[model samples]
Target: MSFTLKPRNGLPYAIATRLPRFPFALILLPMLLAGCEAELNLAAVSQETSHASLRTDHYQALASNEAVSVLVGNDGVVLVSPDQGLTWQRQQLPGKPGLIDVDACPDGSFIALGFDNRLWHSADQGQSWNVHALPTEEQMLTATCAPGGAWWAAGGLTTLLGSQDQGASWDTTSLDEDAMLTTLQFLDADQAVVTGEFGLVFNSTDAGQSWQASGNLPDEFYPHTSHFVSLDEGWVGGLNGFIYHTVDGGQSWQRQDTPSTAPIFNFSANRDGLFAIGDHSSVLHLSGERWQTVPTPNAPVYLRAASSGDDHRLTVAGGRGLLLNLDTRPALAAQAQ
Candidate 1:
C-alpha cells in the first residue's frame, strides 16, 4: 500500500495513495493513557514467528561516548555498544517527549529533534542536554550536520531550518512550505536534499539558502521517504518495498526492486554498496544493481542509526542498544581491484 501526507490542523497524517486490492483487516486495541507502559504478550508468539530477532542480552548500550553510542528513538534516548547490549541509560527530559531523531555533531555534541517541534542540544556527548525552543511545535523529523559545521532539520508543514553556528542559533528557510519533510542529507557545505510526504523532493545548491522542488518522482516509485549515501549517490524507499536510486545527483531517479515490504527507516552506503534497515530487524544490501538480504547473527533488533566512516566500516545502532559492524573492506577492495 502507498501513503501520502495530508495536513490536518497544521499536522501531517499518512493517507493512502491508493485503496488496497485485497481484503483489508483492521485491528483496534484499547488506547493506553499517557504515562502508561505498554506491555506485549510475547509468550503467545514464538521467537521464530516474530520478525524481530531479539538479542537483548548480547548488546551493551553506552551512556556516554567512550562506552556508549547515542541514538534517538520512540523513547527518550538510547545508548548502544557492541559489548552484549550490556549497559543502558536514559535521559529524563523536562517532559516525557519521545525523540524522533538524534545527530551527533563533529564537535562531540548532539542534537535531538522530536515530536511537538522540540529540539535539544547536548555539548557533552549526550551527558546532559538543554532544550531549545523551536519556531513552531511541528515535529522536526530529520536533521544532519555538514562537514562545514552547519546543521539543518526538516519536518511537519514542510519547514526547514538551518544553523550556521551550530545549534546556538537557526535561520528558518522557506523550503518546501507545502510538503512534509521526512529525511535530510547534507552532502556538503552548499548542497543538500530532503524528501518527505507527497511525491516531494527538494534540493539546495547554496547551502539551503534556497530550494527548488523536484516534483513527483516517477509514479512506479513510492515516496514514503528518501536519503543520500554520498554526494553523487542516493536512494529512496517507500511503502510496498519500493526503492529508487539516483546517480547524477537528483537530476534523475531509477526504481530498484527490493526483497522486503518493510518500511525502511534509514540508509547508509560506502563504495561497496548501499544498506537499508527497517521493521522486523531487517537489513537490505544493494551492490551495484543487485539487491540481497544479509543474514545477521543478531535477531529482532531495529537498526536505527547508521554512519559510514572513511575506513570502510559501517556502524549501525538500533533496538535495545544493538550495535552492528559490517566490514566493507573485502567487497570494496574487490570492487577496486
Candidate 2:
C-alpha cells in the first residue's frame, strides 16, 4: 500500500538540474575521468534492483548531492550511495515508518521528517539518526533544513512547524484554510515554498518565518512532487499526468500536455530535461514546455521517487524494491505515450 502523505493527504525529490560543476584539479579531474569512462563504456543502461540494507516496505524518497545520494523507504529503511547509485549501503534507523521525506541538508548532513511531527538528524549521512521533538500531533509529511539546522516542516491539517534553535524547540503555524500541505523546500536560507492539494501553495521569501498564499493551481490540481532548477524555473507533477512549469519562480504556472494518465509520483530535472516517473513505470521527459514519454521496462512497478545526478545518471525508486538507473543514454525523443 502507498504510504499516504497524510492519513489521506498527498505530497512530494532531491535534484532538478546540473549542479554547478566543481572546479580545481582534485574535483574536476576525477569527474572528467569518470565521465570519460562512462562514455567509453557506452551500453544501454539497465535497471538494477537495490534491495535496501534493511528489509522494509516500499521506497518512498530519493535525494542527492554530487558526493552522496540517499533513498528512504517504509519501516525505517535508509540507503546511502556515496558513488552515485552504483552501490548503496543500508543504514539502520531507530524505528518503523520513521520518515517520509529525507532531505540532503546544505551542511552535508541529512534530515528526515515523518508522522507525529517527528524529525531525525544524521551527521554521518544515514549511517545513524537522532530524533528531535516537534510539538504537534499532525504528521510532518515534508520538511527541509538550512545549514546550521534552521528547519521548516509542513503537513496535514495545514500544519507548519519552524525551528530556529536547531529543532531544539519548534514554533507552529497554520493556514487559515484546511488543506494537506505536502511539500516544503527552501531555495536558499531566505526563501521557500510549500504545496498541497486543490492547488494550494504558500511562499515564504524571508527564511520561512512567515508565508503568503502564493496562488492556487488551476483545475484544483494536486501536486505530488516539485523541483526548482533555479529560482525562476521549476516543475511540479501530480495525478493523471498533471505537470506544471513555472518560469517566474512559480508566480505563474502553465500546464504541460501529457498522454499518460498515470498518476505522476515524482519529478527530477537536469540541464537537458526533466525526468518525471510515476504509476505504471511511467517515465516522461520534459524539455522546454514539451513532454515526451520514454519507454520503460514493462512491469507492475509503480515508480515514485526520482533524482538526477552528475554524468546523466537518473535514479528512480518505487514499489516492490524497484530501483531503476537510467545512466547516460540517447537524446530523449519527443514522442507520445
Candidate 3:
C-alpha cells in the first residue's frame, strides 16, 4: 500500500522513500509555652573534637520534571508530574539493563520490560520491583495491559506473547517473517492490534490466539511504529515522518501531513488531539484536519517520548533530561469556535 501526499500547510515538502537499517519529604517542629515564672542557671563546659571519615559520591545525579510520571529509559527508571516539568526522582533496578517499555497497570501497579527479556512489577508506585524472567530473550518492543487482567507483549524479530496471569507465565504466538513487532494495543479483552516494520499490521479477534494481516502499510516507510489510544482511533509514525491515522478499525487509513521529513520517533494523543516529536528538535501539533508547527525554546534536543492528558496539556521528554510542557487550549478552542 502507498500513501499519496497532500500538503496541509503549504510548507516546504520532503519525500520519505526506501528502507534503511536502524518522591516526598516530611518535616517536624516543636512548640514551647511560657509559664508565669521561670528559673535560669549558668554553667561552663568543655567541648570535645573527633575526626570522622566521609565517603565520596559514586553516581552522577540528573534533574527531571514531573510531567513524566513514569518512564523507562536506557539508564534507569524515572517518574514525573504532569502539572510542572520540574522535580524528578530515579529508582535503580538491580541486574537489569536497557529498560525499554513501561505501562501503568489498572490497579495502580507498574510493569516494565527490559532488553534481557525480563519483566519487572512494582506495586508500590515504582519504589521497588520484582523481576520475572521470560522464557526467551526476544527483546520486548511494546507492552500494554487490557482493562481486564490479561496482558500482552510484542517484540524482537516477529514474536508475540500473551499472559493471563500478568507476566508470571507467557504463551507465544506466530507472526509473519521479518516482522519486528514495535507496538501493541488491546481495545478489549478479545480485540487488539499490532504494528511493526515493513508495513506489517495484524489484528486479532480471539484474545490474541490468532492474527491475520489487517492491512499493508507503505513498504518505503521502514522501522514503522504505531500507537492506538482506543479501538476506533489510532495513529502510526514511521520513517521520513510518515504518519497514518485510522478512525475505523484497520479497514482504511489516511496519511497525515507533517512538517518535517526527519524520522518521527514517537507520537501521542489525548482528548486535546495528537502530538508528534522527532529529530532536529521538531514537534508538530494536530488540530482537527490540520497540522501546525510548535516553536521550542530549546533546540537540538532529541525527543524520545510524547504524552497528552486532559485540559489540553502535553509533555515531551528527551536529550540530557530535557522536558517540555505545552498547553493547546487556546489554539484548540479558537479552532473550534
Candidate 4:
C-alpha cells in the first residue's frame, strides 16, 4: 500500500498517514521531509515563494493555456511556467495540502483540487491563487472545466461536484455507489463522462444535471487517465499497461496494445495531436493507426500530468518534480528534414 503524510491537527510536526494504491509512493514521504529535519515547515510552503530552482516535490496534476502552465501536487506545491516548460516559479498553499488534480478553464483561469474539501482558483495563470471550500470532504480526485465555464469534480463514495460561480458555491450529486471516481472529462459544453473503480462509466448529456450508465470497463479495472475526443470516442489507461478504446461512447470497448506495463497517469491533446504519459517515463503519442512510444530524458518515474502548449509542445510533470517540454511533431517530419 502507498503512504501519504498529511498535516496532523494543522501542526507541522504532527503526522497523519493513509494507504494509497501506489506503494512506490511510500518513498516520497522521506523525500518531502528531507530539507527540514527539525519539524514540518508549513509556513515555508504557504508564503508567496518563487525560485528558479529544481525541487524534489511530487507533482501530481497539471493545467495549461497557450504558453502558461501550472503543476500541482504533494505539499500544496504549485509550479507555474509562462514560457511552456522553459522556466518555472513555485507557490504553496497554507497547510501543505496535497493537490490531486488541476484543470484549465475556458476563460483563462485554473481550478485545483485538495483532498480536504477545498478548491483553489487562479485567474492570472499561476501568479496568485484564492482558495474556496467545497461542499463535501470526500477527497476529490479529478477535476475539469467544461467549455461552458462550469467546474466539475468527483471522488470517493461516488461524490460529484459542479460549480458555476468559480467555486463561490457548489452543487453536489451522489451516485449512491461505493466506488471511488478517479477520472473525468468534458466532451464539449454539454456532454461529459466520469469513470472510476469497478469499471464504472457514466455519461451526462445535460451537463451535470443527470447521468446514465454507458458501459463498464474491464472487470476490476481502475482508470488513472482518460482523454475523450468526442462523446462517442475516448481512451482510458490504467495499471499493468492496459489501454482501452471506446468509439461508441463507452458502450463497447476495444483493448489497445501499449508499449509497457507502467501505470498511465495523464492524457492531453492539442493542435499537434494526442499524447499520454505515465510511470517508466512513458510518453505515448497517437501515430497514424497506432500508439507509439516516445523516449524521455529521465529514468523511470511517475509522469502524472501533461498539457499542450501554443507552440505544439507538451509540458509533462510528475514524481520528484520531473518536468519536460516535448516536441509533438510526427517522426516523419523530423526524418524528412
lDDT digits (tens) for residues 1-337 of candidate 3? 2223332111111122422322000000111111111121111111111111011101111111222355555444445343333334455577534455676666667777765677777777667788877776655666766657666678756788778887777898768566568778777778888877676778878878888787656553443456676666678876556788887765677888766665566776757667777654456677665555555543444556666655565566644445555665544444344
What local lDDT does model 1 show for residue 97? 49
Please give the range of 10 consecutive residues that has the lowest summed lDDT in model 4: 32-41
Clash pairs, candidate 3, are 66-80, 66-81, 67-81, 68-80, 69-80
lDDT of 2 at 246: 80
Once fitted onto the true fold, the runs of candidate 4 whose alpha carbons sit more than 4 angstroms away are 1-53, 330-337
Candidate 2: clashing pairs of residues: none
Q: Which candidate number has the best TM-score?
A: 4
Candidate rank order under lDDT: 4, 2, 3, 1
TM-score of each: 0.70, 0.80, 0.73, 0.83
Model 3 regions lying over 4 Å from their true place: 1-68, 80-86, 229-233, 247-252, 330-337
Listing every candidate in turn, what is its Cα RMSD in Å to the true structure after a full C-alpha superposition?
9.6, 10.7, 17.5, 8.5
- Per-residue C-alpha lDDT of model 4 across residues 53-167, encoded as one tens digit per residue: 2445767788887648788877788888887766788787888877878888999999998766688888988788898888885757778899999988898777899998888
Stronger candidate by lDDT (1 vs 4):
4
Q: Compute the lDDT for candidate 1.
A: 0.55
Computed on alpha carbons, the lDDT of every model, listed in order, comes to 0.55, 0.66, 0.56, 0.71
